[model samples]
Target: MDPAKLSNAIENVHRAGMPGLFAEVRDGDEVWRGAAGVADLSTGRPVTADMRHRVGSITKTFTAAAVLHLVDGGEIGLDAPVGRYLPELVPGERGDAITVRMLINHTSGLGEYLPYAYPSLRAFPDLAECRPQSLDDHRLTRFDSTELIEMGVTAPAAGAPGGTPGLYSNTNYLLLGQLLERVTGVAAEKYITQNVIERAGLQDTEFPDGPQINGPHSRAYEAFFGMIDPPRDYSVFDMSYAGPSASLISTVADLNRFFGLLLAGEIVHPSSLARMQRTVPIVSQEGKVIEYGLGLYPMEAAGGGIFWGHGGTTWGAGALSMIRGDGGRRMSVAMNLQRWNTLDASGRPQPHPIDDALAALYRVAMSG
Candidate 1:
């Protein structure tokens, strides 16, 4: 691949007000790794490939793998009703019928009930409506997992038949996190760290206890719901605020390493990995796109190739991790700017540089 085109592409994305963009492509050896823009706009610290950004639901893949490992070991059964493992969280009648497999596949039909889904119900009303708070602020970093669970459990469900067959909810994974801990007798973070992260050797990656984003890294900011330009500072809004389902931080290189090992059958058993990727039909704007697999998403790429990976977006950060169908090549990108415009007729969004960056990165990586 031409280095000039790559540089130009990165430059264009940087100019669009993203704090920075970093990408790493792996093919037997790490290839074409680069970073651009400042980690902190105020301090003018240049972005580096090592700086961490939250990976969002990509963390789901790890959670799913942990559950499957237990399934493969005969400690848990995918077909067994979830109530057998977590009776408290599972409703009586519905609990007996819903299996663990349904939760991983988004076939559980549990409504997504994120407390942050509504701006009005926030725990700290003053902090809730504020645009983007600086990470340095004391009131913001105080957010933690306990508060997250409290808000989540009380939030309303998306539908009635809790585990019917067609809805995606973070609560399913949250429940999975709790179940994994129950079966293993270890916290979910430690279980995944020992079985997944440490096994894969991801040095810079971490799953903090709550939603804290304290580190020597880029300052995360977001484009508010109605705003166009990126806000000055959102550091005050920590991943700790979202807890496990949404709070994982990592770098492009670390993410690429983790996903590469995952698909290569290094961290998970082959049979279990196979079960994690099985697709199911679901309702969509179009007739029906593919529903989620275990922890990953199996989607058709812009260039007409099916890839397994996941994308995570918080208020400010956006993460993309993908492994080609063959699982031999992978590409990962992490950006600090979040843009919300819809893709045009060609499935392209120009003003939002992420769309272009994603397309070009996909083209080059998928070419192999």
Candidate 2:
């Protein structure tokens, strides 16, 4: 790999508006690591490759893998109704109709709970309402999992269970966390730690239960609902609101290791791995085409071929990890900024800087 070009790419990412960015790439037997910008804007702390950050929705990949481990062990069934495990939680006709596979693949039609629990710009689709002050009051609030699930369940379903045109809902994985607990007699975090994190030999990844990140890490920051305001430090906010759906904290190195093991069938059975890679096209609320599998996404590579992984974003952090389908290459990138996009005065959408950064990183990571 050309360090000069990679360094220039990092500089470009910094110029794009991220407070800081870090990336790790494994090309065959060699590994390349890079970072640019500040980890803490107030202190001007430089970001390092090993500094941890919230990996956000990438936690779903771990949750999915844990659930699949139960499936592989015959403790749970993919096609089985989630009602089989938590009949009371799901309950009645709706419960019986929704299957484990539907939840993992996001075909359960479950509505998201965040908007209902905390009305913020993230819940609103219009860019005009995405103001920084919208979420300022609830930054320190914590939510119970049961109440969060109830918020989603009481709302109308997104579509019929097992229906076509799947909608992405964090509620699906929230319930999956409940399902994992029901079957394993352990919390979702513990199960994933033993089965996925440890199995992947990841020392820097964890599902945190509190607002504090327990190790050396970059402070997370967000532009507050994508509004044009000074970025706020959100590194200490509670993640229980996200639970198993989006709260895993990790470094790029550990993320790349986890994806490498997952894609290589070391974390789950090959049959299960194959099922995890089976994908369906999803049209985002913004009308972009995304191919989603159980917990993985099939992103087009910079050069040619396909890579499988997931991207995650929280209030003030963002992460992306991907591996070649054939397991020849892998990369993980992270930034200490979220809601980085906003609308111009003309109502046109301004793209996030990470878009350009990832494009550059992908070119370098996927090169021969």
Per-residue lDDT of candidate 2, residues 62-128 (tens digit): 9999999999999999999988887877899988999999999988888777777776545345556
Each candidate structure's TM-score, on Cα atoms with residue i matched to residue i, is: 0.83, 0.95
Root-mean-square deviation of candidate 1: 4.8
What TM-score would candidate 1 get against the native?
0.83
The best candidate in terms of lDDT: 2
Per-residue lDDT of model 1, residues 289-364, tens digit only: 5566777778666657778888887666778898877776677888876644433444333356555665765676
